[model samples]
Target: MSDVAVCSVVSHKFVPAQGMPVPGQVPASARAPRNDALRCTACSMRAICMPQGLTSDELKRMESLICPSRTIKQGETIYRANDSFQNIYAVRAGSFKTVVMHRDGGEQVTGFHLAGDSLGFDGVSSGHHSCDAVALEDSKVCIIPFHLLEAMCREVKAVQQHLHRMMGGEIVRESSQMMLLGTMSAEQRVATFLLNLSDRLRMRGYSPTEFHLRMTREEIGSYLGIKLETVSRMLSRFQRDGLVDIRGKDIRILDHEGLVRV
Candidate 1:
C-alpha cells in the first residue's frame, strides 16, 4: 500500500464521536424517507453527496430529521480553539480554515475546508476542538448530532462507508501536506499549493486556472510555512516566466505545464 493509504488507515482507527445521544435523538417528524428532495434543501454539497441515494419519500422522511442552521459570515468564528464539541459540522456552502495559535500569539493555518468539506471531526475524541475554525466567507452548514451519526453507523452500512471514505480523504490530504512541507523547495511548495487549490476549485464548478485569491498573501504564506515577502517574490517570478499572471489577487495560469515543471 502507498503512504496515502497508510494515512487513511491510521485516521480511521480513531473514529471520533462525541456528544451524541446514546439512543439517538429522533425528531418527532422524522418518520418518512428522504428520497424525494428535488433540491439540495439546506446543503450545497447535496449535489456531491446527499440526495443521490435518497428518493422523494426518503427525503421527506429525512427532512424532518434534519435541522438547518444560518450561514456563518466571513471572518466569523465558527468555533474557537478548545470550545466544547457537540455536533459534526458539514460545509453546506462557502469556505473555512482551521487554525492554531503559536506561543508568541501568531496564527498558523492548519487546513482549509471548502464547500462540501467537513470540520470539527477531529474534536470528537477530546470533546473540545484543538484548533479554531473560522469562516472565510459567508457559509452555511448542516449540524448533525455526532452521537446520532455514530449510532447510525452501527446499523447503516452505507453511512459507515461514507464516513470511511470521508475520513480516508482527509488522511490523504493531510499526508500530502506533510510530504510537501518536508521535501519540496519554497517555489515547489507554492506552485504545488496553487495547483491543488485550482483542482479543488474545478471540482466545485469554477474556473480552475483563473480565479481571484480569496485568502491574502499573508494568509497564503502562513498556510505554506513561508514569509510574505517570499510569496510575493515567487509570484513575480512566475509572472515573469509566463507561468501565471497576477494582477492584485486575480491569478491566471498561462502555462499550467510550466508551473508544474520542477
Candidate 2:
C-alpha cells in the first residue's frame, strides 16, 4: 500500500491486561478491525509520548506526514541492530524490550519500553540502530519518518525542545541503569526495579501497586546484570517478606514503604 494512503493511525490504544502464556492467544485489540485515526492528535498516548505546544498548523502537518501505524506481535522485532535508521516510533499499544548482542553471543537487554514511550533515537547519531526492539506483547507503533520530523523540528521551536527533552530523558535513564548495576545490591536492585515500574505505571494512569510484568525473569536479569536464578530468588524473598506478591508474571507491590527501605 502507498504510504500516503495508509498514513492514518490504526486505533490500538493500550489497555493493561495479561494472562497465562498461551501461544494461540493474541490480544483481541490486535485482531480488531483497523480504524483510521487522526495520527498524533487521535492517539491516546499523545500526552505522554508526543511533543507539547504544537500549533494547529504544525499538528495538521504532523497528521499529514505520519506513516501508518505498524503491528508487531509478541517476539517480533520492529527494528534490529544495524538496520538503517529511517524512522522513529511511538508506543501505541503493548510494550517492548530493546537488546543488543554481546560479543559472547548473548542478548543483553538494554531497556524495557511501555506504552507512551518513544523509541529509535539510538540510531540518530550513527544512521543504524544499535539494538533490537522486540515486542513483549502484541503491539503497535506509530511510525514517524525521521527526515520529515527533523524538518518539522527545524521550523518549530516547540518541536525542537520536545526532541531535546526526549534525548535528555534517555540519557538520564541510561545513567540510572549504569548506577543500578554498579552501586545497588541484588535486593535493592529488585526493589528499585519494582518501584520504578510502579511509578511509570502510575504516570500512565494504571494502578501503581499492581500490574503484570511483561518481560520474563531472564530478560529482567539481563537488564539488571543479574542471573535468572537471582531474579527469581529476589522475587521469592520479596513475596515472603510481604513486599510483593508474584504469581508467574503477575506482580502486586504489597508494601511500598518496606520495599523502599530494602
Candidate 3:
C-alpha cells in the first residue's frame, strides 16, 4: 500500500460562475423538510465541525463558504475515485464508507465516516479523490468549497489550525489501522474495533455501551483484515463470554473492561 499523507495546502480563490446559485443558498430541492432543517450555526454538531470556536461574525462568514447540505441515499456513491476535488464534505447525518480500488480490481475498505466527520482530504494533493466514498445509509453532508475554504484559512488562524489537526487525525487513524492489521490477533482486533466504535458514538452523545452496527460483518472483517467467518466467530465468542450481547446488528457491551483485555 502506498503511504497516505496529509492533504497539501490548497491555495486558490473561488469565483462563482455566471448563472450559478451563490454559495450557501439552499436550493428548494436540496432543503430538508421543516422539522429536519439544516443550519450550521444551529447544528448540534457544530462543535465537532470546522467552524468550531469561531465567533458569531466569523461563523457567518464561514457559512457563506459552504453550499447547502445535500443528502446521499443508501448505497449511493458520494464521490468516486479520481473525481475532481472541488469540495470536502462534512457529514450532517448518517454514515459512509470509503474504499480504495486496487489495480487487480479488488477494493479495500479504508475508513468509515459518521456524522461530523470530514471527507475529501485524500483528494487535495492530486486534485482528485483517492478513493470512493459511499453512503452506508441515507445521509446528509454540508459542502465546503475547497478554494473558498483555503482563502478563509489564510485569514482565520483557528480555521487553518483546525484543518491541520483534522488532516493529522487522518494520518494517525491510518497508522493505527496498519498496526491493527499487522499485529493484533483476531479476537483482539475485533475487541478493539468495538471499543473504537463505542468511543466514537459516545463522543456524539450516543450510549457507549449499546448501538446498532451500521456496517455488515463482512465490511467489518474487510476493514480489520480478517475473514468474514472469523469476524462472525469472534463476535459469537464475545457474546458467549458475556462480553457483549449481539442480536443481529444491535450490540450491547456487557463488559467493556473484558473487551479491553481481549
Candidate 4:
C-alpha cells in the first residue's frame, strides 16, 4: 500500500482535523466524524495555513502542491536535527515541541507549536533542520514541499508576500523569546507564557480562561529557560494567590488581571 494510505489506516482513530472536540468535552465514541480528504479550501485551518487574498481557484492550486496530511503520534519525532529540508509542515491538529541539542549533549526546548502553526522554517538557510520537531500529542500535519512552494510563490504575489510575513513573524517571535529569557524574572516569564498561551488558545476558538497544558513542567521550563522546580513553585504560588486553579495538567485562570500584574 501507499505510505499515505498506510498512515491513514494507522491513525484512523485520531486523524487530527478541525471540529474534533477536545479531550474531556465528549466521549470518544460520541465525537463527530473527521474529514479525511486533504483539501486546503475545505480545511478548518485554511485561514491560518493559506496565503492571504487567495481566491478559491488559487487555493485549489495551492492545495494541489501539498501532499496528504500525515499523523505523528505523541512523543514521535516529526523531523530530526540535520534532516534535509524538503518540506514545511502545517499543524492540522494537536501540538509539537522543537528542541535543539547543545554541544554538551543536553537538549534545549526551542519552541512549542499548536494547530495552525508552521514548522521547519529554520531549515530555509542551512538546507537542513537545526532542531527536532516532535509531537507533544497525537497530531497531524499537511506537508508543503519547499521547492514547489517556492515556484508557486514566484507566480502568486500574495503567496510570496505571505511567505515573507511568516518568516518575519518567526524572527519577531524568536527575538521576543530571547528578551523574555534574558530580561524577565521567573514570575514575569511564567506570567507571559500563560498569557501568550491563553491568547493563542482564544484565537483557536478555545476558552482562554480554561484549558489543559499539552507540555509538561519540564518541557515548559526548558522553553522558558527556567528550572523545573521554579515552575512548580510559581504555579503553586499562583494557585495560593487566587490567580489560577491548577488541577494536574489542567489550568483555569481565575484572575487574569492578577496574573497580568505578576
Best by TM-score: 3
113-195 in candidate 1: lDDT tens per residue?
77777778767779888887777666776666666666656765656777787778768877877888788888997888788
Candidate 2: tens digits of C-alpha lDDT, residues 157-209: 98888889888988899889888989999889888899999988888898999
Candidate 4 clash figure, as a count? 0
Best by lDDT: 4
lDDT preference between candidates 1 and 2, better one = 2
Cα deviation at 202, candidate 2, in Å, is 0.8
> lDDT per model, in order?
0.67, 0.76, 0.77, 0.78
**Which structure is stronger by lDDT: 2 or 3?**
3
TM-score per candidate, chains pooled: 0.81, 0.85, 0.86, 0.85
**Clashing pairs for predicted structure model 4, backbone only:** none
lDDT of 3 at 197: 89
Residue-level lDDT tens digits of model 4 in 126-186: 9889988878778998777677788889999999999998898899889888888889999
Show the lowest summed lDDT stretch of 10 residues, model 2. Answer: 1-10
Looking at candidate 4, the ten consecutive residues that score lowest on lDDT are 1-10
- Candidate 3 wrong stretches, greater than 4 Å: 1-37
lDDT of 1 at 206: 79
Query: Which candidate order results from sorting by lDDT in descending order?
Result: 4, 3, 2, 1
Residue-level lDDT of model 3, residues 1-262, one tens digit each, is 1111111112211233343243454333233222235667678788887556788777767776666677776777667887777778899989888887779866678888889899999999998888888777778888777777888899998889989988888889888988988999999989999999888888888899989888888778778889989999999999999999999999999999999999
lDDT comparing candidate 2 with the true structure: 0.76
| Candidates 1 and 4, the one with greater TM-score | 4
The positional error of residue 125 in candidate 3, measured at the CA in angstroms, is 1.1
Give the poorly placed runs of model 1, Cα more than 4 Å off: 1-44, 51-64
